[model samples]
Structure formats: C-alpha cells, structure tokens
Target: MSDHERKQLEDFLAAIEPNIAGYNYSTFSYLAQKKGNVFELAQGRLVLQGVPATSESKHFESPNLKVGFLHLHELKTSVKQFIESLLTGKLLTPHGELRFAPEKDRSHSIYFNPFHAEGVPFQNRQAFQYRQMQLHIRGDRRERLDSLSLDWELKAGPIPFEGVQELCAEFGVGQIDGDSSTVEIVAFSVAAIGGESSVTGTKAKLVINLVDGLEREKASIGYRLIERNAVVKRGILSGDALTWENATNFQRGVAELEVTGGAVLHCVASHGGRAQHHYWVADPATAQNPFRAIHQAFDKNLDVLQELVTKAQTKGANARDLEIAVAWLLWMLGFSTTHIGGTPKTSDAPDLIAATPFGHLVVVECTTGILKEDSKLSHLFQRAEKIRQTLISCGNQHLRVLPVIVTTKTRDEVKSELDQAHKNGALVATIEDFPQLINRTLLVPNAERLYTEAEENLKRLQNPSPFDVSGTKTNLLQ
Candidate 1:
C-alpha cells in the first residue's frame, strides 16, 4: 500500500474508533441497497432509505441515519466486486490490513472491525450486542476498561460462492495442494450443512494442505467459529497445512460449538502481485447415512448443498453427479420427477422430467458447459413442445410444459446465450439460481410455488427493460 493510502486508512480508523468502542458498540450493521449502488456500513442500526448522513454525529439518531459511503465510481463497477476486493485484502479499512495478520492472533481484530475500542467510553458499551461476551461479577474497574476488545464475526448471512470464485480469479491464488490451474481448496470430513445434536461430542475436523512449490511463503488463513449456523468467532489459524479441530463448546459455555453446523475456513494467499481468496466449508455431523436413498441423502446429510455446489462448480468433470443431485433436489422440492437420463431407454430424452400434482411440468436438461449451439435449444424446445402436444392429445390441454436448462455456469458466463434460450422459450437456470432453488426447497417446499417461480423467472428474463443507460437499474441491477 502507498503511504498516502495508508495514512488515509489510518485516519479513517481513528475517526471511527469512538463509534466502535465499548461492549455496546462491538458490532455494526452492513447493508447494500439500490441494487448495490449504495451500501451502508453503520455502527448502529442501518436504515436503507431516508437515512440522512449527518455532519455533527456521522451516524444517524433513530428513524433514518447511516454512516458509511463509497464513491459512485467505486460502486458503479459492482457490489460483488467491491466485496471481493475487501475479502481479498485489497480494500483497506479500520480493521487490520486484510492481506497481513499478526501470527497467532486469535482475535482477528485486524481483519475488519466496523467496531473499534480506541476512544469510546467503557460505560457507553452496548450491552447484549456482541459476538462473544464474558462477564465477571467482581473485577477491577480500571483493568476491565483497559481490556475491552471484539472478535471477528459475520453479521451478514452466508456469502455466496460466486463472490469467492470471482475474488480468486481476479487476484489469482497460486498453487495449493497439487493443482495450479485454479483455486482448489477443499474441506474434508466435516459436514457441509449441519452437525449432530448439541449434546453429542462429535467434533468436526478440517484439513488444509499447503504443499511444496506453493508460490507464497505465508498466507493469512482464518475460520468462522460457529455455534449452530451463527458465527461466534472469526479467528486466524497459525500454522501451514495443519489439521484444525473444533471445540466441543464455545469458551466452555453451555452452547455447543459446531452443533447444527456451519463452518468455513478462508485463506488469502498472494502470488504474482495478486491475492486469491479461497474457502473450505464444513456442515455439522448427521446420523443419517448419506449413501442411503436420494431422500435420505438430502435429509440426513448436512453436506448435500456443498456437495451439489461442488458438483455444479466443477460441472463437466462431474456432470453426471450434478444431474443426479439436481434431480434429487427437485424430488425433495415436492416434484414427482423422473430421472430420464439415468436409463438407457430415455438417454436421448431430456435429462429429467419434473411435474407438479397440478399438471405443471418442466423438461429439465443439465449442463456444466457452454450452451451456444442452435441445435441444442431447438432440441430441448422441440421435446418440450412434443410433451405439451402429447398432454393436449390426452385431453390435458390445461397442463403446462416448460423447457428448462440448468447449468453450473454463472449468469455473466451465459449472458450472450440468454437471448437464444428466451427465443426458444426455455427457462435457463444458471449457478446463481441453484442456491435459491435449494433455499426455496427448504423455505417453501411446495412444487406449485417453485413452478410459479420458474415461470416468473422465465418471463422476467425474456422481458425487455423499461430503463435506459443512465437509469437507476442501468448498472446496479443484479
């Protein structure tokens, strides 16, 4: 970092220190709105609209006030890009320099602290608003005041993989493990989604490899200390390629750690003047065998989502696995699905056929690669049309048959071909939509609702926008 930039960061940190000090001020709220053009990073409650930026207090009072700002130019590029920059340690803030962390620093106060305890009064501490808290009935007041600090935790919900992937590609994380081709960090033996009951002593173990020929001598690595799915701590790991084990309890409290699980180990490794951000996730342990039945696998295994996400990200290499996982997910979403591609007789047919009880049906095709061939869309559309005709002939004219293509590719990766998919009357579900699909399965679990959602998404994709280049959604629309 340049001296000017360093000074600016230090000044900003100093200015915000009072706002972040004390127990009451240990955490802040972050929100991105206006479709990512505007983001609020406030030490107190963040209001989206009508929050005026005040000169006297920097932060707002109650009804409407926010305390952070980014240049229009900075946000115009993209919100995800901005976040990726921050995660990769490119963006400097009050916390520490993201790229560097002090060795053995369990308190990652350096990573990012919207909260700082420099000038804020000890008496002004915000009670019941901390990630990790400890209270002593009797202690030296001066000593207690002198020892105030905050641990790193994510106030925001889980971050999507797309953001992490983009960061790695942009900064270029060098070789780890044996693969130098791209970001290849993996988490083994941990549940990808959920852990066992809180009483059980099943601990989650994570193994990270920093083998020979690694471009960087040291990398900043950290993990989300989780209780259930909430992050209790975000601490730095001290060694290279070490096996880290989860604590059975949070600071020896009643609340068990890693139970009902969600955990992530993040690393920012630099090489060739670029730093890459990689994540390894583990869900908590479950009693159900993941290899049993499709439904059992989805029900008992906490790692189902991660497994599916991995398959989608890897795509072609594990194309068949992706197909089966999607099919299984559709089934869990209350769809009566037929795995057509699984059988030799229907190998040439659409990959899967999913139908709602109310006669809404989707002809599904799974792909992990490009979808540019005219013949491919034509074929999917034709098959769907044939199915529609067949239903009409069978006196089910009210039935709906929608051709759908599911791919692990990102929306930008398939943007150019979206018009073709729309032209062919096909609903193209990219990697962006997969998570929502799974979330809907958990949230709604109604086939009819998902069918409606698919229909709506298709319409939205096919429709023309009402805004021009200078309009509100021109650049901010996700």
Candidate 2:
C-alpha cells in the first residue's frame, strides 16, 4: 500500500480501537508466501493439533487469540466487516453485555437480548424466535454528554430454498441445496453521537444469513439507513398543512443522512457483496446540480483534463492545442464530429461548428485571451456578428450561434464588455464552468429540450425590459 493508504488504514484502526479493546483483541503480523503483511487478530495463544504422527504440532506463543484475518488490499472492507462481526459476537456472548469503560471516565454499554425465547408476532412459532437488544454509546467532548443509545430486534429462522437460487445472481459463490437454519431479520438504529451538532434518530435494517456456514458464499446482507426528517413538502393542502418553498433544511438533513448511510453501506458491502454494493443518495436538490454528477461520472478522467488545462495555462497556450482540447470537450459532452474552424490569424471563420442530435446547428467562436480593451471587445463582436451572418445565410434557420471566449482570468472591464455582448446575443462562459455546462447539457437527454432551453435563456438575456409596467396607473390599481 502507498503511504496515504497506510495512513487511512491507521486512522480507521484507531477510530475502532475502543471497540477492539472492549473485546481484548491483539494483532498477529507476519509475512506470508502468497500474501504480504498478513495481519490477524486473536485473544490468546493459538495452537494447531491433529497432524500426522511424524509431524509435530505447531503452536503460536502470542497470547492474542485469532478471531479474524485481513488482507492488505481489502483493508478497509475487511476491517469494517471485522468490526461488525465483533459487535455481533459481543452481543451474543454468554454475559449478554459488553462495556467500554475507562478509569475516571464515563462508560458505554451494549445490552444484548437477555430474553431470546420470546417469539415474533405472526411468525411461525416453531420456525423462528425474536430477540430485542439495545446499545449505549458514550463519548467525551468539551463536557460530559448523555449517552447515545439504539434499540433493535432480530428474528432468526431457517433459510429458504429460494434464497439459494437468488444467491447465484452475484458473481462467485458456489451452489447449495437444502434449507440452512441461518436466516435473520435485523432491525436497528445507527445512533449519531458526538456533540450537540450530531444528527440522531436514524434507523436501518438488514436481512441475511447469520451463520458462518456458507462454504464459499459470504452472507447475503442488505441494509438501508432511514431518515424520517429528510422530506420536502410537495404542496400545501387547502387546510392547515405544510408546504415546501425551500429545500435548505431538507438538504442539510440529507447531508447528515449521507454520513450515517455511507457507514451502513460500507459495512454491508464489507460483509455481503463488495463488488455489487450500490448506495443511492436520493436528494433531488443535490441531484439537480448536474456538475456534481458529471464530476462523479468522469472522476477517473478529471485529473487528466485538469492537467491539460493547467499545462495550457502554464506554457503559453498553442492555438491548435486549445482548439483540439475544446473539440475533445465538445465530443465528451455528446457532440459528434466537431469541426474546428479558421487557422489562427488566417481565416475569419468561426472556431467550432457542431450540431445537436435534433439538428440544431451550433456555431462557436473560441478565444483564450482576455477581452479587457475596447479594441479587443470590438474585434470579438465583429467576428461573432460575422459568424452569425454566415450561419444565417446557410439557410438552416434552426442554427444557434454561440461565441465563446476562453480566458484564465476575468477583469471588471472584460466582464462588463462580455455582459453587454451576452445581452445582445453571445454567451460569456469561463473555462472553469465548461465542465458544468457540458454535464448540464448531457443531463438533458432530449436534444430538442436542450436546444429550446438554451435559446430561451439567450432570448431572456437579450431582452432586458420587464414584461409588466410597474409604474403605470393600471399596475397601481391592481
């Protein structure tokens, strides 16, 4: 692992150290033939027997007993799973309780189901049993705080035959037959504890195989974190009802939910199916930001694009390189066969010509220099107008002309000129906003809607006058 990855692992280990200490665990580290840096956890000396008479029994002098083994490559996922198993094992211990209490400090406790014989309501009496449990978590900030607690219940029963069939859908995992008495229904709350700012009252559920008897198939665990307050008012009723005019509170609540939800998903992925794990953040307000989604979609390629943009700025940008990069960006935004126009200082043609899928032609004039001076502004306007005329004369009335000036910085003078140009007909967009625009365009699956939206925005910019006469006598009477 790299230094950064090792640090991440160390931090994670430290975060869960209290829980590990509660279980009296220690690590056994050694080198393996196939795996590097083999780390295993245990509580006491581990010994292996039952070998052939000719071979002597092997014994480990380490007092720590082995409870889990982890591979470095799967460090995060494995650690998460190990922690879950530790929590579950502690709850199922004979004492039915686990406490994390230090000298001269507040104590936290987890209480398991002291009464496991109780049957679930409407369950097959002979087939299943229910057990209620609770967990109390304590922490110290600036002052002593109330213990954060979570209550939960579980139902254990025999695994069904269809469960085996469904397990085949995921890659890996051997086939199995016959019912395994290992299914469980887990309902618990993931308490958000720390300071007053911490979000509380989040519930989650998991239904899966509980027994570690699956030969090659890990447990099929599924989980979801539920936040009751994460809701927006659709509309108000005629009577006294709630209405959602803004999403500020909802957004804030969802952000908290993401933290708790991400943890639960991480644990599930660790124990269930790491490759198939998928978590959906269902915040419509955040989803509307196409730029964020686009960044996520191109996360792997963003560094390369950023590097190119930086290189262009650091080394005086070559016109050809900038044009080619812009062309590539257009293509990434779903444009097909982008054509770069006019050699630098040679032709008066537009810099780019492309068409939307719906036949809406786009003519673009690209530049990399700041338009701070009147001469530069005038030259840009003339070029854009010329391009607009050329496009109109082509007889394709569906064409849309966009003059784009790319620059590293925007001064007040340049911005003033660009704003005026935009009001007239052109668009002034920074190089940084290009990714956002591209993502927004791609988000609109319908070509006609995209074209219409762009045209409407431009028209709105061009017309600065208000629709209503605010100072008129008619307006005053109304």
Candidate 3:
C-alpha cells in the first residue's frame, strides 16, 4: 500500500478503538498465562463422582468415585464445536447469519456475520441497552480485505443506567458499568472476506422505541422492515404498510422511508457517505417554490400609480406627483434623474433632468394649470433656458427639452395658447398626450431620432401665418 493508503488505514483503526477495547482486554486477561507459547479457550462436559465416607473422617465421602478433565486437544475441539452450534443456532435474528472460512491467503481463520444480501449491516447486538450501531466501509481498496467495522455505543439515549443494564440482560449481551447511566459496548471488526468489498442488499430492518409521554411513563417497541432505497410517495405510512415487501425505488441512488409520520431519506452509491449508507430525516417545508411568491408581490405593486392619482388633494400637487412618478418611471427605464422643482434657489430650473440609457440628456418643466397667452409661457422658456445652460456647462452635446402641462382642461381648450408657445421654440405636451410622448421617445430605436422627432413636432404646432423669425427660434437656436 502507498503511504497515504497506510495513513487512512491507521486512522480507520484508531477511530474504532473504543468499540473493541473491552472485548480485547477481557480476552487478554482470561488467556494471559500460557502453558507453552500459546493459550487457547477450552470447554467440556462436566460430571460428578461420589466417594464413600470413612468412620474417622469428619468430612463424608463416597467410595469408588472418579473425576477426570478432558485433554487439551479434546478441549479445543469441543470449544470449536460449541461455537459452531451457537453461530448456526436460533440465538440471532432470522435475518442474521454467520460464516466461518479460511482467508484467501490461508494465513488465518475467518469468522463473521456474512449477511451481504442485507442492505447496510446495522446490527443491535445488545437489544435492551440504549445504543447506536454503525457500519463503516472503505471503498478505495480493490484487492485484499478493505476494512470492515461494526461499532456499538451504549447508554446513548434517554434511558437510565439501570434500565440499560436490564435491557442488556434481556438481550443476552455482556454489560459493563452496570450502575452507571452511560457505557460503551464492545465493537466487532473483521478483515475483508474474499470477493466481498461493497455492501449489497435491498432491504433494511429498523427497530424503534416509542415513549408515551415526556415523563416516559409508558413505552412500546415498534419495528419496520423497509426497502433499502425506496422513494416514499407519501411521507406517512400505516403500520402494516411499513415494510420492504411493497416498496419501490423513486429514483436511482435516492430512497425514502416513512418513520413516525415523517420520512427518513437515504442516498446510496459506491463511494462517500452514500457507500457507507447515510440517512437523514426529510423536511417537508423545503419543497415550496420561491419564485411564485416573488411574482405575487410584483403583481400587487403594478397598480400603485393609479391608487396615488385617486387620493391626491390639489391639482398642482397632483401634477407634481405625476412629474415625480414619471421621473421614477424613466429611472426604471434605465435613466438617472434629478428632481429640481421644489428647490427654492433653483426655481428657474426645470422640474426634472434625466440622463437616458442611450447617453442623451432630457429636461422637463411641469405645470398643473392651463398654459394660456400669459407669463406661464415665459416661465417655461426661462426653466428650459436654465436646463440648457446647465447641460452646456457640463459639456453635454445632445439634449431634449419638453414642457409638460397637466391640467383638467382638454387639448382643444388650450390649442391656441399651446400653438403660440410652440412658435417661440418650446416643445409642449398636455396631460392627455404626455404618456404617449414618453412612450414614443423610449420605444424609438435611435436617441438622435427621438430628439429630432420632438423638435419637428414642436415646429408643426407653430402658427402657419408669417411671424417674426427671431422670436420663433429664440430657444431653438440656442
């Protein structure tokens, strides 16, 4: 073996030390004294003989009696025979069986529980004690016996020390620390058997203890023979249906088995935890779809703008709200916006200035009342001029400016005044047309074309009759 493989083997041996310590110590103490260079366990049948009592003797004895001990060879043979009887006997469960054979190299005798047809071997040696049993298998080694170990822990549950002792006796397994609440059991190990390295089986037998209440006043035993890797369609199972007899695999490598109204999920493979047969309880809550919840929340927020429009008090405030809403809409459409309408020192500034995703700037001026033949038009021009100067100072070469008037009045009602303002080089739109204008600008394929269309639309709104060229092109020329 390579150095790394040797280290892994050493680690595996170190981890299972506690499991076999008790058995090794007891066996060593029993056979410590040697007649020659070796010592062995012996057994034989016992017989009693009688000796006759003498008149002068205080102790009575029967005459013509004899006692004899078996020879070492006979003793060894008898012991082996007894052990073979025990292994093939009904002492172990029907699902358990023993095997004794010679190692492949014929260097040592091999005796072990060879139940490879059973899933992973989870044997509870001492049925009465609160203990845990585990089987660890190493899969990397192909030749020779990969390490096989059966580990046992005692008093590993809520049961008291005396309770475990009684259980150990009931189960017919030796117990240590009879008075202590917790103890460790002897572990069993075997070198690999010939042609056997991986676990192969299709069924598992599970035994569980049920307590009636928290105080543990009453208890009962329950067992289920389940398929090794079955997928449970329903996590719950009735008492009679909990068995490997009717189970089927849900998917390759994964299996589920019901336990106490829940489930025990298992993953089996040829390597890693799966190779060693690891299992855990499946949680039901993790099966929910997360995106469904997100979509529900998204649909709920889609009508928020209409709700805000219905609840506002004044037309001016309503118009301002719409402007801010539109600015946010532009931001969501991949633009950066600044709301300057409410800043006292920047009153001449446009209500909003935004940088579009296509690398152009847009300035907007908003009004809640009708734009008539009055100072409102001059104020719009001043705001537009301020925005133009700001963009020029920042070295912005391409920009679009729009004057938006959101009023209760219809488009026809302010057509004359809107026409006059447009002649003075102001791009204007009423409340009813604002949304359409924004949509058109956003949907256009080219940013330059969007600005060009806005300018042409403004020119189309000018008076057809001859007018002063200087006044009409005032802001447009700049």
Candidate 4:
C-alpha cells in the first residue's frame, strides 16, 4: 500500500514482485498510528474463491475486477487453516500473540492477524484505531481462494522483535534498523489471486492484526457474506447473448474449473492502474470450461499483422534489444514470460524470448482471446501500458507488453495495432504470434490454460447455471 515510490522501493518491486496479480484497488484505509510507520496496501477487492462458470454476465472468461471489505469477525476460525499450515504450520483460532499464514486454496498472499487479542481471544489491543472498510463475497468454499505465491510489501512499525523469532526465521525476514520514522521491513505475504475454484464447502475467514498502524489504534472492517450462485442459464448458451456470435459449441457446462483456490485476498486500500498477472491455476477438472463454438464475426485474425510487425517492422531491431526492454516492461505486470497471449498464434513470443541472448528478464501477459472485442486488451490496455512505464525506471529491467488475444472477432483490431508502439521503440505483440508449448518462456494460453482462467472468471461471477456473460463485468477478481 503506497503512493509515490522511492528508487529503492520501486527497484525492489520492479525486480521482486509482491504478488501483484491482475487486480485493481476498490478501497484504501489507513489506521491511526502514533509512533509506528504505516504502509498502504491496495489489494484485489474481488476474490476468485468459487467454482467458475463457463459464462459470466456476457461470456465466461473475465469479469470486472470486484471489491469487498473483510473483517476478522466474519471469517470463521478455520477459514484460513489451510493457509496457516503452509506458513506458520499452525491452525487459525481466536487465540495467540500474532501469526501469519496462507489461505489453503491461494498461497500467493498470506493473512495477517493477532495471534490472539488482549483481554479475550479476540479483543482489541488498541482502542483508538477506528478506520474500517466493508467487503462482500458470495459465500462458497469452492467459490473461495485459489493459487499461491510469495512476495513482499512495505511496512513501517516498531518491531515486536522479542517473541516473533519463529515467524521471522521461517520467512527469512531479518531485523533491520529499528528507526520507526523511516525503515522499510521486507514484510512477507503469499497469494496467487486467480480463477477456478475447487473448494466445494469453504467460507472466507477474516484475519486480525495488532501491528503497523495498530500500535496506537485499531483499524477494523466488516466481512459480508453474500449468496452468489455459480450457474449458467440456458439462454446464455444461445448465440443471442454473446459478444462472440460464432461460438456454437456453447453450453453452460462446457466451462470446467481449471485452477481452484487461487488464493484470493482482500485489503482496505484504494489503488489505480494495471499491476501484473498471476499464473494462478484453476483445477481444470473442477473449473467451468467456457470455450465453445461461437459465431464471432469480429475476430480480426491478427496473425498476418503480427507477422508483419515481428518479421517486417523489426527489420533493424535486434531481437535481444526488444526482449530486454519488453521483458522488463511486462515484469511489472506480475507475470513471468509463461503466459503471453490468450491462446496460440504464429510468430510465437516464446521463440522471440529464447532468441534474446541478453540476460534480460521475461515478462508475460495472460490476456485471453475470448475477451477482446476491438483487438486491443480493450479497457485493460491503459493499465498494462502504465505498468510498462512504471518498471522502465529499473536499472536492468527487461520488459515486453504483449497485446490482448481473446477471440477471432478481435483479430482485425490486433492486426492493425500489432506495432502501434513499435514505431516508438517499444516491443509489442498480439496473441496471433506467440508460440510457447515446449518452453516455459511465453505464457500463451493453450487449450488448458485458456480453459482455466476463463473458467475461474465465470465461476467467480454471481450467476445461475446455464447463465450467459452478456454485457457483464470483464475484470477478473484479481
């Protein structure tokens, strides 16, 4: 949680991502702290914690980034138990000094709370702190938490370094200068807030914390349980509700859960801009597989345009030069070069990345082919571009911002803009050109990856079975 960043902090995030998946902030809160430092966190408001639907409000891939407040009281005791086992090797309860653990389904981000509060198992130590936020989630274990990863966040507070040795040693956190005014602790957290819920009988558990701004006061938020149904309506299966009209194999049950328990988390922080894409896995077995035969006349078939950009536009551009710059650019996007375009295309991005002999990094974007309408990443383009710019300040940032790749309808749109930024010395590509089956270099969606992210998006939405994602929110619960 931060606004203006320092060179060190910026550089740190540039190289070491703190699990910034495809999420946007919907809330921000700062607890009053007298002597401790306060770090701001703008995490995902909507979490992918349920089995996804093959279709959403319109389709079945991505829904709008959702938001909901979380509170310690709302989350049942054993909610984050699976997560605690992964980290502190304990269980979640209403007693203890303080502990941090991961949600079972989601491991990328961890939960923070007082091991146990003051007077009782759940008493407020600080009486002054009073800022809070509210969040709502459709209660479902299968509808909760997915994936797992580890990263860092900035936190400034007086270290209760006496008895927290177990926590610090486990996470490899070292004690730094004790200056409360200006010291950044490499706080540890885990999570991979992605799609496709496999948890069938789960509920969200809230975490209670006593540090950070809690030194003087308490910051609290309420967790709301909303009844969200993971279903698809038969009407959506018909061609009338889809943006991609050609999808004929369209069926409510086609979409299967790919990645389950993507480790979704929520925080009271308002944030803006595009972050990164977590290679969050969905249990394909359980996820809703949404890809079907649809009549999408809009598919632009940007393959030809992508070929022109990489083969023709990069006439004098060194493959190494492009890889270094673009890798660094996309790294800020929270994804390695594993998932590039939505699906497979020509001019494979993985090959391009492999050819780059530079010790540059690999950046990947996981835009699905079924989402784009005008070929562009659509609404998410600006955030991706912003992330590209944010990471450029890093010394050895190697970045690549691939284009959006969803369906055939988006082909023409991508074909023309394949090299929009190439003229300005930026490396860009569309899904039509990336091939990365054998190598882990490019994050291009295959039949499996495509189904996973899409299925998760569909399940996380509040819909009925056989429902269609027509005119629905496209943001995934990042």
Candidate maximizing TM-score:
1
Q: How much does candidate 4 score in TM-score?
A: 0.18
TM-score, every prediction:
0.41, 0.34, 0.30, 0.18
Clash totals, every prediction = 12, 8, 9, 142
**Residues 418-463, model 2: lDDT tens digits:** 5565655655544444433433322323434544655665555566
C-alpha lDDT of candidate 1 relative to the true structure: 0.40
Model 1 lDDT, residue 289, Cα:
17
lDDT of 3 by residue, 1-478 (tens): 3455445434533434432311211110000011233211111121110111111111101111111222213223322232333223211112122122222332211112111111111121111112222221111111211112101112233332233233333322223221111111122221101111112132222322111111111111122222222343333222233221211211111122334322223322111111212122222222111221232255343244333332222433555665665565445444567887757787666677766455556666555556652355677677767667776888874655555434323354465576566666765554334333322222212334444555655565554435543322212111
lDDT assessment of candidate 2: 0.32
lDDT of 1 by residue, 1-478 (tens): 3455444445434432222211121111221111132222211121111112232221111111112222213233322243344424233333212121112422112122222112111121221011111110110111111111200111121322223222222222211111111111111111111122122334444333222222222432345544422455665433334333333211000112343323322222222222222333333233221222345544554266446656556524556666887787777677888888777787678788999979689898877776654355667877898888899899998988888887766565676787788767787776555443443333224678667866766666567566532111110012
Off by over 4 Å in 2: 1-299, 342-346, 372-394, 411-413, 438-447, 465-478
Q: Is candidate 3 or 4 superior in TM-score?
A: 3
Query: RMSD of model 1, in Å?
Result: 21.4
lDDT value for candidate 4? 0.24
